[model samples]
Target: MPLDAKTLCLGALEAGFDTGYDIRKAFEDGPFQHFQSLSYGSIYPALNALLVEGLATCDVRNGDGRRDKKIYAITDSGRAALKAALMEPLAADQLRSDTMFAMAFVHLMTRDQVKRILDEYARANRRLGEELGRLLRDRMCEHPGHQFLLRLGEDGSEMWARCIEALRDDLVAALDDTREAPEAAPTGGAAAMTARDAPETREPGSGSRPGPDPHHPRDPR
Candidate 1:
């Protein structure tokens, strides 16, 4: 089943994240790890629902006297609600994301499609890097647990952004090479099909067909 806004809001508060971004990060961090995850796409709407229900309240902190930033904390009722939710049986986890599943087909995709995917991911990562950097430099350091969390957030975001940027570079290089060199025979398909059909024969001599030699590509005979 799906998680309702109220329970999510309460759980976030119980986890000690005072703002929507903080709560979002809590889901991404290793503490929750495989158990829970959410992004701004889920956070904002749920937070708004919580506010309307009077379960949480926001306070403003002015930045450089330019614009005020709003941070939220749980109310007494919110704490009570969170405790009640925690006492309940765990619900089955459900995740739905077509964008991620599409990534499994990167090798099978057209060159243009692969390039587009990498470039899109790079842009998204760069945006996240900027957001996390701003939060660390301007806001998170002053808070308690936030300092450590901000450090983790910075490292994680930077590494992830770098990885995506590297992939984009690799794809661009492949495109450049393809423009220069003539096409070669399609590789890996026939071998992959064979593997799929007779995976148990992978050890060699376990079946009638001979397996590929690990030491050399050419046959000894």
Candidate 2:
């Protein structure tokens, strides 16, 4: 089953992200990044729910000459809930990427467009790896498990970037050999496509072929 935004918020609170904004960042680009994602829209509601359920506490404090800020912290109940959730059967990992989904429809794109997409994807992956590396260098993750996870994500991202860069030219070359196929080509293989692409139907009774006539007998000789 998919993890809910509320549960993720609890994890972020326990991880020392005391503010709603910080919680969102944790999933966007901090420790929770790469493994999980959360949107601000979901984060705020979850935080509210946590407070209501006594799973978390919040403190309002003075801000930089502006509205006060609310700092969130997980309660004992929240920690226990997080622990229980983790111990349950975990969901299988999935690769959720917009770039990857776009790549699957490459036939709809031009060669130049395809090149740009590949280049951008590689660059983004490289950036992610570097960011993770910086976190490790700054000693943000102290525990061995935390370090291990960051290192793993960093290495995996860097390796994938390299793989994409290496295979780009070959993928482009292969794509060049194949013509674009119709987006809505029916199933059942090429024959089905052929039937779909056949000449459009005209009037129900209108004869398309010329009728044989005595005046044009003997093959019109």
* Strongest candidate by lDDT: 2
TM values, all candidates = 0.44, 0.73
Tens-place lDDT digits, model 1, residues 1-221? 45565677577776677777778776774233334677788788888888888888888787786666668889988888777776787677576657568766544455677777767776775666666667667643665555566566566766766676655555455433433332242446653433233323233333332343322222236
Off by over 4 Å in 1: 93-221
Misplaced by over 4 Å in model 2 are 177-221
* Predicted model with the maximum TM-score: 2
* Per-candidate RMSD, Å: 10.6, 15.5
Give one digit per residue, the lDDT tens place, for model 2 in 1-221.
86788899998888789999998888888876989989989999999999999999999999989988999989999999988989998889988788888877665666778999999999999999999998887867677877898898899999888878776776575455443333354557554343333234332452423244412132233
Q: What lDDT does each candidate get? A: 0.62, 0.78
Clashing pairs in model 2, backbone N/Cα/C closer than 3 A: none
- Displacement of residue 51 (Cα, Å) in model 2 is 1.6
